[model samples]
Target: MSRVLVTGAASGLGEALAAAFEARGDEVLRTDVSYEGGVETGASAPSSTHGTFRLDITSDDDWAAALAHVEATWGGLDVLVNNAGVAGGGRLDVATMDEWQWITEINLFGAVRGTRTFVPMLKRQRSGRIVNTASLAGLVHPAGMASYNASKAAVVALTETTGHELAAYGVTAHVVCPSYFRTNLTSSMRGADTELAGVVSHLVESSPISAADIAAAVLEGLDRGDELIVPDQPARDAHGLKQSDRATYDLVMRAQAAKLEGAPRG
Candidate 1:
């Protein structure tokens, strides 16, 4: 069975993914900053094959410590799931630099750091998988969530590049672009201004899938050696829109924004 290390496993999609892997008889090491009340109390905790640990994805020291522990305990890691992320939504013109950096740090840089530090261990194994949790926002631009959109976009690019780089080493990378899934990510979303609150709320209300479904898709993608896994219908459609016509996608998003925001006619 593969030994998997999942970051952000304390809650939400990460927690669900960890449980799913463990249920399938894979060795799972679940890590997240919130240890006491996060995944520790959820479905992830009761899984027979899962173990929990504390991990702060934004800290290099935390990453080092977690990896060391995994190496010592499991001997080596066969899969690394970079699933920790934060969400922020609002007008780009009003977004603060601090907000942008914070979102990028957890959503984009955290994945980069995890991949960088764990790639060597994976290479030592001579075969492994890296799964980065990118959002559908990465595939298509949506209004009022500029920071989250940009960070996830970066994740997609990073995953693609890393997959190419690690191919010769027998390491595979998968980027999961999931559409609105029912998770606490919406509750955790940070906003510097209240101007876009209604817009963000509307987006959250449009969620069509569950976190468990996304988690299942992630595992399936890994098994199939798929590079890009769009977990739900909305994600697939968003990706198609991106590939087919950029202008049309933008127009559609604008219309969605106007409808959600209840804006007056121009």
Candidate 2:
């Protein structure tokens, strides 16, 4: 069984992923900012059993502690799932610099920090996987989601880069770009536009698939060695259309933009 570490594991997709790994008999370290009593930036622990820990993804010190924790407890980590992120978005003109930075810090740089902290260990072992949770917005940019789209797209690019750069060391990287699904991701939603935020929430709540379904698809995709995992059918269809039919893709995108133009700003 592989040793796995998952961020944002208290609920939603992260929780599902941690449970899935445990179900497969893998040793799992579940973490989230919601938990308390994280070790100081440089504390040492001899060992720990499979369980949860407090991990604030945006904190460098927390990441350092996490790396140390893994070394002490598991000896090595086989899978690192960077799944912690906040939801934020708005029209480019409406989104403030603060909003952009807040979302980018956790959504994109959070993954970057985790990968940076653990890559050396992965390289030394010559076998490990990095799984970043991006979004369908990363691949197919929709209107009124400028900041979120940019952040997730960067994650996709980062994963692609790592996938190529780490191949020589037998380390593989993957980015999951799932569309709207039942998740508590909206709980951390932040934006200047309330209407847009509600729209996002509705989409998330109304999705046909659940977090467990997405987690299962992610695991299957990892087993298949797919670098880009689009787990949901809606996302798959949208991406396929973007690839195979430029005109239709443009029309769909523009139609959404038109609706946004018609809606009252919050």
Q: How accurate is candidate 2 locally (lDDT)?
A: 0.91
RMSD values for the candidates in order, in angstroms, are 3.3, 3.6
Q: For candidate 2, what's the RMSD?
A: 3.6
TM-score of 1: 0.90
lDDT of 2 at 184: 92
Q: Whose TM-score is greatest here?
A: 2
lDDT (10s digit) by residue, model 1, range 33-106: 88752224346455636567778888899888887887777888888999999878667666789888888989
**What is candidate 2's CA lDDT for residue 67?**
96
Minimal lDDT window, size 10, model 1: 36-45
Model 1 stretches astray by more than 4 angstroms: 36-45, 48-50, 257-266
Deviation from native of the Cα of residue 189 in model 2, angstroms? 0.7
lDDT of 2 by residue, 1-266 (tens): 99999999889999898888878888788888987765322132112227678999999999999999999878899999999998999987888999999999999999999999999999999999999999999999999999999999999999999999999999999999999999999999987888889889999999899999999999999989999999989999999999999899999999998898777778
lDDT of 1: 0.82
